[model samples]
Target: MVDDVADSVGSVRPNCSRSWSNSGSFDLRFASDANGKYPSKIDFHQIGAGFGGHFWFAHTRKPGAMGGKMKVTGTWTLDHERTGPMKIMAALPDHGAHTEIANYRVNATRGPGGRVTKQPGDGVRWVSIGTYMFDGVVPKVTLSSETPYGTGENDIAFDAMAFIPIDGQYHEHTVEADALFDENQNIDTAAPESWLNESPLESRERLYNWAMTMSDKILSMKNCDSEVGDCLTPHVGAAVANWRSEVMAAGKDPINHPDGNSISSWIGFANSYKDRPDSYTRPDSFDDDSRFKIRTKATTTFVSDENGKIVPGSQSASYANRTADTHLPHFVLELFRAISEDYKISLPDLGYRAKDLNEHNGEYTSVDPLRSGIIPGRAYSYGGQAPKLTTYTGSGEQRGATCVAVRTVAGGSIGYRTLLSKEGPTTAMSDFSDTLSNSQYVAQSVWELVENIREMFFDSGSFPVVESSLYNVAPPIWQDLNFRACTNETVRKVDGYPILRASWMPDHYLYHNGTAMDQSGALRKTSLPLMRGDFENFSTATIEVAHEYTPYGQCRAYVEDNSFARNKNPWGINPVPRPGFNPSSVQFCSDPDLAPDPEYSSYDVS
Candidate 1:
């Protein structure tokens, strides 16, 4: 919430300083600027209606077509600004000609008039550029100079742009976030590569603990309910796995790849090199990879005909020709690695990511995925197939907005938030408000994705066999139990396959009536950071055991499981409630009428 006025902010550092000539310019603001135009204690307008100042653009008379005949549009831009197309609003000048300012170039026709915002999280201005979902290179919206009639247009006065949250909550109260951010202002000024000397990648106490938390959620098999805590079901694991693969395939992720640095090998890499341990988590290369770092020009996407969605492939502008790119050769390999372990979640492929397509793309006011026909927003990855998920994004960044006749784009996202610059996983993570928006976006998108996956499996007309754990009979899905069941071998199967439980173990998790997990019960116990017994050999140890155990990292999953589980809930069961193929599907050990098999297998690799 920094005031545009230079003097208003508490302090200006080298990274994020502002120039206040109190005049006008052709300068575009970097919305992703790690150090954005800070606000002052003294609100200029005093009424929260607008941010501190404005950008007044008066170009030296046009030379050609937009030539002297029409007044040229001013250049106020937000580079690396929009993640996906959300509602974009601008502070309209006291004049009438510039009502429509955003890049979309929709007539700026005033709708029943409520709020529109841009410059991501500034303040909801008066008009809009509608809503869109782009996945091209670096997301940007330069409020180009106004040329209403190509002549006789009024001078352009562009004030701050604001990002309207999907919930329409404009005042995010940055004041609170500001103080918290100030506390973390301590920056690490070293080159990113030098951090390797910081040591002990494998035996990191802090990172190991964090890794355990992630592992717990995976094992929890939490339902599709956000009302429940973190949604880390097998479905989520698959989504994460798939997305990680996608980024890597795009050549985006390099360092934290499975083939390279096992996350265990470098979870706390940056923390080790931190100048001040207490500072905000400075990612590997904040200075070099920030979206706001530096870029000479803003990249261009397109101005679609408002009627663009009604036709087949109605990209009336230029893309196939110019091959316009938001990210050349696909992904921006910057921030994808910065927070790989935490935010990016870019681990090596777990070998179980399924693809399903669901779309939620539309106009801001008419975009209702739950209520409208499912259209795919690029982020929704509709047609993106998972088989798909948007588990993380911030408010106003994409999801939060109004919509009109929900238009389903037939493909996947075609936009990337960048310019000539790159983003660190820590880019948006730095600011509290941006972080909040990002998380909200991720939550909504992921929810849509996971739910879509569930529907896809159910609709496929076949039972879903997510993981291989030893639990129940094949058809009855007795195998959704804890991984420990893998040791017995009797009930270890997924849809009749003879594989040990490896990936996607939370096929149909059961939440017993009481007691905390890890404290008791067979299927719901806590997971060990490392495997047990002979598996200990995988760890940094020289143990002499009677039998050599298999390390989890090297565990093998021989067969594919497609078993059915009773998923019947109050919603009525078609595919049966989760984890219930049949009544006789109980593990031989858990079966009341059966006796334990005389033969015992000590280990289950995966």
Candidate 2:
């Protein structure tokens, strides 16, 4: 839903989730980029690269700046990060606060360390402030920057808001015990918190699932009979990119020299951005104003002034679909940030400098083709172990039992991590866990790679496809605890639960060219690793779900079960955190015990 709800209070939809059906579908997405709509130009304060790169910052302290106001003219209101692909891309500045509609105050900031706070949440999802009755009107709810904080003392974030219609009856779960844990499944405390960290198990789950999905994507798609979008990836080039990144990061790039054919203008990124569009101008369908427009191409940059307001910088349409961080699409650049942030996996934990991720022919090998592990290179390829889209394995000639290089590139040794104490041992130990790093980077790298190859399939009239796309997987609703792989072949779980009996790994492998060959996946492997790759390809994937169903939903007792949400300010309400007085036998939700559907069969990943 929404990220920083700001000095006012955080407002998010109670039932919203980052993982949902129809996630990657094209939709009415409002990009939260600055449009320079604010009245004054105060010095803008920089926050982390959040929704739409950064959010709008303002303060009531400025003589003429009291903060901005947003009017949502609808029956109900909600906010979403729009961290996915969009059909309608209107740049809206995202951040800050609001005064009221139902007037529910929320936990607006991370205790002290993190910038954004979660009210009823993991903070990543849009948690609801509260659902209240509102008359059908032009301005259903108006949010203002004004807060109880002393003038100029607090800075308000003016960010994007989403307006939605809700059913007449909807409420949040209130079982004291069920609502007790933070996203980490821990009891709440006054202790300062780090909003960025997630339960390690959850992170590991995501990391593993991501790996299975990445490899499946590479292997599942057949070389298009007629070359439709270059079979959805640029495998060889990705490998080359990693290779180059390794060489370059160590200040040993051979391509950017006087004699070599060059692609590197920089060490990490390829200056391969090509022909651009003249301008991007489309009507903002969401905006009733006849003149408002949207641009799918790029968002503009703004610099803050003295009063926390911003002024437009020299940025233009070139930024369309490009993220400020990597100048890459959202799927690769921003999504990388999201996977790491949402799941709270650190790079060090994952092992990725990733300079090699986008290179032309960069690659790092894992000891076992299918099992995930890091081989010796410069340790550059962020998306290491991800199979190349155009894996020229069989296309080359090989001489060894396993794939071997026919001609080893010269400079690879100069900047290689192997050149250090790690030298001579060409590959890494077989450890499938490292596959997470491969999947994380491949998740992003493959998107644009596929897009570009498709264009080469046809012909791009203008700029490349740049978009922030969101992808997620969850167990089928109504069958909450019946999680399983398509068959017991791919997924191995505890009886009727989310626990994995063993770590899953991919079994599929690619054959290499004669004389010189490279292999992917493994023949020794019998079952595919937790096939989490649920895209157009039907690869098996595992969604590690750990739910605590404490029967928190509406109890069957009807009106006698009215919960604390309606208890004005609820903090003083009684019978909370599951006092011993309440029996554990109480039933809740449309179902209790999270019973599994007897006939469920699909392990859907979407």
lDDT of 1 by residue, 1-606 (tens): 112233444222334444433222233332211243322111112121233423343322222432223333334333333333334444544332232212323222221122222122223344443333433323233544322221223233445443332321111000000000011111121122113222112223333343344334443455444443344434455544544444333232223333323332122111111211122222222222111111011001112223221111111110000001111111112212322433444322111111111111111111222122122112111110000001112111112111111100011111121110112211222232233235632334343432332221111212222221111111110111211111111111222322122111111111111211221122334211111111112121111232132111112222233221111111111212232211111122111232212111001100
Give residue 71's lDDT in candidate 1 (0 to 100).
30
Query: TM-score: which candidate is best?
Result: 1
Candidate 2, superposed: residue stretches over 4 Å from native: 1-40, 43-48, 60-125, 169-606
Tell me the spans in candidate 1 whose CA falls farther than 4 Å from its real position.
Answer: 1-85, 95-125, 134-137, 146-148, 164-606
- TM-score for candidate 2, residues paired by index: 0.17
Model 2 local distance difference test score: 0.21
TM-score per candidate, chains pooled: 0.19, 0.17
